[model samples]
Target: MAPLKTLLLVVVVLLPVANACQPPRTLHVPVFHRDALFPPPPSAKRGSLLRQRLAADAARYASLVDATGRLHSPVFSGIPFESGEYFALVGVGTPSTKAMLVIDTGSDLVWLQCSPCRHCYAQKGQVFDPRRSSTYRRVPCSSPQCRALRFPGCDSGGSGGGCRYMVAYGDGSSSTGDLATDKLAFANYTYINNVTLGCGRDNEGLFDSAAGLLGVGRGKISISTQVAPAYGNVFEYCLGDRTSRSTHSSYLVFGRTPELTSTAFTALLSNPRRPSLYYVDMAGFSVGGERVTGFSNASLALDPATGRGGVVVDSGTAISRFARDAYAALRDAFDARAHAAGMRKLAGEYSVFDACYDLRGRPAASAPPIVLHFAGGADMALPPENYFLPMDGGRRRASSYRCLGFEAADDGLSVIGNVQQQGFRVVFDVEKERIGFAPNGCTS
Candidate 1:
């Protein structure tokens, strides 16, 4: 057989690019719920998918808290891959081989499962082979990209070889490989060349069937930061209804879009300890137009000294989480309104949700409106579907139950998950350091 490197050098022609006056001002990529990775079997239980997701959510919350505890450590650790709920199709390399990558706003490194498995987990598609791409190049140890990694390593052969990366998650899942760069392309025909990435050769985890992760966090090496210059450090995303199998396609957009405009804007908080995570000021919450009392600014404020307490807007976690006390207050207020509205509370189990209601005979109006009160005047009015997630996976039968999607976090940091973010265009303006919420923004 020919030498591996020489054999992969076969010339292949590619189509000419359309008249490029620079890539589009914004690029749109379709995103989907993790359940879309594969079709369920005929005998699969209707609620099994959601039940498993909620179990993963619990583990995800635990991992998030553990990751925060090691904030000052040199290791780059984060939530488990099995905890990821949404994914987007991404293209990489010269010819742009497509792969399904978890769209994560929580981490900093962008990596994918590569060819030559050294203990690779089973994935839906063929692993990405860097040798097939003409533009593929290994990042050297001396390069700044390698230095940016929190857990960067040098090739065992010495400093002359490619830089190495080892990312270990809280659940013991890890990806170790050489740091490299290639063309990162989108479906819109726009592409960014020489984008740094990890070509994982030794990988293991409960990543499901997805190829890898696409980090869009605020770290220097994150895709959002690396592509910030061209896109003006602005991007927006709107998650579709995850409970519906026939829902419209969700989107992850880079750069400004007409739908990103929102009347309500909140100042982005910063925690020097964990700068990669998006922080927000959550003043309080309301159920059925009545403001839930007992939650003060300190209840959700970021601790300047410890950098521990605060709220985060994350895309990977399945359910929104809040501080225990704060959650109890919110739950009580919701229960009061639910009782007054004639909605019957169920003693049955539904994931971590303590407030489950059987709305079979109750009118739609009986379900109270839940609103998030931010520091600014922005009042995010969540639709019934956003907060009252259907207990059944995709079944909307009259016998089904809807549960409050919020849960109590084990730690101080509260996370607003994708479930609550559905149907709203969430704009992350890194340049201005503000986050915007536009209602009914998932038109596409």
Candidate 2:
């Protein structure tokens, strides 16, 4: 017994020394959600075609609630249209709803033209009423968040405190109302309760069918920032395209993910132009497995006057647009590959690439990979889907054609939209200067 006791004492003493000699363990961050965070699947009967379309639209509007819990980029229809901008909707509050509301980012409030409006649009969902909800509380005008909205000069003079304000968009869309809180439910595991939002009146634009604009951009009062202080400052979202309605979804991850660090794609810090915004380093664009040149050393240009870098990674735009030189090189390479495939040149100077043909009616598997080269000699290989879609332009309207086009932009930056950024897990880290891309697909 005495010998055993002495041996245990020696083991305990050596344990601390052994731990001290070992290197510190690195902290692991998670990339994807292991469990659903929002409400369980709704048992309501399948919605009508209209209802299905609205739900589909909502999924397409990808948003990121930040560390502050403010929402950014309320995507609509998979297109990243400006928020706080006003648009008309057919239905708003009624079963056959139609109404107009301003889409905003800087403001969390989402309200519609209601009660006694001469030309009000209809809405599909129940209108939010502060008086009806016991949890509703108007924000005081004196709050810093309210003051930020004062800049665009759209404030409509209300009792200001907590989370409320009238806001406008760059396109002259405006809304007036008291700011309040509400619940935001995403199809994924994201349930944001007590989220600051706008409740407005007298909205315009009566053709839009959406319930209202979701304020998901980076702003002081946006959904992500406002909720972060209370609910761990993290939000996630998934966006789906029109074609893959049921199975397709994309996510917007706030803060950091433990699973991303191990990805093969290198992560680079975003440029510090918009302090709140994040961007990923685009490596390069490729055609048919061949690496296109000239974009290797591309540096995002910062507009000193605007304090924002024009380069953007958008999942909304349908095509990849670039400056003149970059566009010419990419277009030419694709045309060359098409000509080699025995495709006749069209009157519009379009060449068909044989590589675009496959027994499956898709690009052949043997076709070269369309690679995008990055600054560090890194490359992102895009699948055929990234470049070709059902061709719609020219006299060949209904006829199927596969080709690429480039549009010149005044801004000296390249845009990598959803059409091009497919097949990779793009992680946007706003706090850090890095955007990480992993060679994985949402399907995988």
Candidate 3:
């Protein structure tokens, strides 16, 4: 991957602001609740605490700020994976071993493909062995959670308890295995031990880069919910990129806030309509100082049965996608800006920005300014460099193309990926009904 060019310049001026009014009577955010499938086993709480201490020490050694002045939180990068996906390494079994897994907030379970096969692509860390873990147990297939996993054509009549099942991703990736317990380590902090996770006997199209996923959702059994009982119901991560300055110290704040100086941005409590999940009130979206009217209200709803929300905040996604009209408006604005720069719009595989030019031509002397306006009157101005990706078609020429793409998903919801989220402090408050954003120094 080419070095990420800093393209957006943000100047955050601290402002004194009053907190939004709190609604009377705390709202009961309906979350999918499940009884522990397996009995709680004895754990070394002191050992867990000791692990946390080691994590703090590790963080001190890894923490560093880049020249741009933005704090580079510790992160583990360069784990191998296919393009356009997210993955992480995780520990499983009596003695924790590492496995590469997808880090999916859209998912509720942190599972791994496990077996005796030596050819299984694995990260350079410990491997999870379910047979050796005494606490490992499975939920019955008849259980509600397992039944939910059953697809439209999948047969529910299975002998396995809720502990064993299979799951398929939209990208055609699938993992089949028994649900079992294992230890999980985050930033050296052993937050949960003998936690329920997938022990897969087989997986197809699984990325070998990540050990396992860290499911950060609101489901009762998800990493967010399981650790909430211990960590104060929150986890934070800064996406990794070539420009990232920190190392394997990337953080996962479980049951506690990652240490940072509080800014003037008011951390609104999440709306109670969504339970066990982070839903932020998105006031609206803007571009170039003008508000795009008729966007969907930021209020989100969580489906307690599935432990998923109607709308979610995902940083791993590379662009900020909106519902139909919002997406069209943003695209149209960008197209207009590109046309103004004298580029002729073209339609082709390498064509982007609704405009294109032959690589042999002189590049435009100037590009128009592209800015995004957010709720609470914050404006993020992005330069042309931020929106374009450098492409080398078969010809020996260099051409810059916009990195924007819009599509309506089968799930009928919009996604804001890393492209739009670049250089912003995204706060996900599960307790509050709103997502908050502030500008960061991401541009040169």
Candidate 4:
């Protein structure tokens, strides 16, 4: 009896030490693309089709925002463009199934196509059968969770039945379904039970192959917020390089304290119009060390009243978009440099770009570099590899069409698209309200 008592005492003392020495909870998952979701493959040298899709989505994304905010209840969509290039594998339901979820930092709700579907977009794998999962639980409309989503007071289903949700994007894409709580499994074999998410039934529009969305936005119901209790208030993602043509997957890291070696810093702001988006301050822009003129500081400030002039680091957008005035300056600067180098202009081209160069005579490596200067000493340099693309995109041999990667937009908001973000690790620190950037993110 005395020996047993001594052993119990030893375990009680050692257990605390063991746990204390353990590292903070963390999650890391791979993010990669499967295939081109929409029709018309990307242009080899210039991603015209890709740019169109992203720009259209960005426009719609800006329009749908009310600027009134969603503090009381969350209302947003993931992969609202009807297509997504990259997705993350998320395990949902009991006896977990690995579901390919679209990655969208612009949204906050992590949704999945649930079983007993009435209407759903065609997905790659088997639909999640809630009946098979013991952990599956439908949230009632009266529940606090449902109420917070503004439940809409149930539907024709019943007065006190499962909560229903509907989110419509500006481009007419929408998801109508029930709100429920289920276990979400991650790549690290760690999971959280009763993670509130939308179990979409009548999901419509152009979502190719993705079963759902992994919303990593700045909202109360976002997956980042849901897991913040255990993982802390930090997440980092290193978008893999598209030029490498390698099979290595990019990564998404969540931790209590983000590990960063970057000296640059930028303040994350808030706008009532777009509450879920991660807004950051952009002090100014510089093209090869030349500051843009007529681009006032007020042009890019966040304003809910006007519903314009804000910036977000989005994972879904492929290329970067700048305000009309700002883009004109940037375009002229880049075009002037290209013209000085004796590059020929491709005439008779009807495209979204203002400057399209005929690169058949010169390698894409010859293009000049551009830099986007952010607040707090963050200067993101865009090498030829980051902004220049072959018109043929290696689709065929013996083709020479390389163009600069940039676009003009009428919207007041500016975006740091995924293309410019490639080859770097972008850290979204909501706790500190700052963003960090580091090179060589894939291996880091």
Instruction: Name the candidate that leads on lDDT.
Output: 1
lDDT of 3 by residue, 1-444 (tens): 000000001101111111112221111111100001111124423223323322322221121111121211112222221223333544455555655454444446667666653334544355566677664556565444444333312225554434465655432345667765555543333324546566666665434444455556555556555544333444444333322333332223333343333311333323233322333324444444566555455322224444332333553343343445555656666556666655555566442123344423535335445555444554445544444444444344444433344322223234444444444444444554334444452211
Per-candidate clashes come to 0, 87, 49, 11
* Candidate number with greatest TM-score: 1
Query: What's the C-alpha lDDT at position 131 in model 2?
Result: 56
Question: Could you give the C-alpha RMSD of every candidate to the true structure, in order shown?
Answer: 7.5, 14.8, 15.7, 9.6
User: Model 3 — which ten-residue stretch has the worst lDDT?
Assistant: 1-10
- Indicate whether candidate 2 or candidate 4 has the larger lDDT: 4
Q: After superposition, how far is residue 203 of candidate 2 from its true place, in Å?
A: 3.2
| Tens digit of per-residue lDDT, candidate 4, span 152-215 | 4486667578888876654456677888877777665666677778888887755546787787
| Candidates ranked, most accurate by lDDT first | 1, 4, 3, 2
- Cα-lDDT of candidate 3: 0.40
Off by over 4 Å in 3: 1-81, 117-127, 133-162, 189-191, 206-208, 242-250, 256-284, 292-311, 341-386, 405-411, 441-444
lDDT values, one for every candidate: 0.72, 0.39, 0.40, 0.64
**Model 1's TM-score against the true structure:** 0.89
Instruction: Write one digit per residue (lDDT tens) for candidate 1, span 235-268.
Output: 8888876655743467888887764445478988
lDDT of 2 by residue, 126-175 (tens): 55444544444554556444454533223356343253444433223345
Query: Residue 344 of candidate 2: its Cα lDDT?
Result: 40
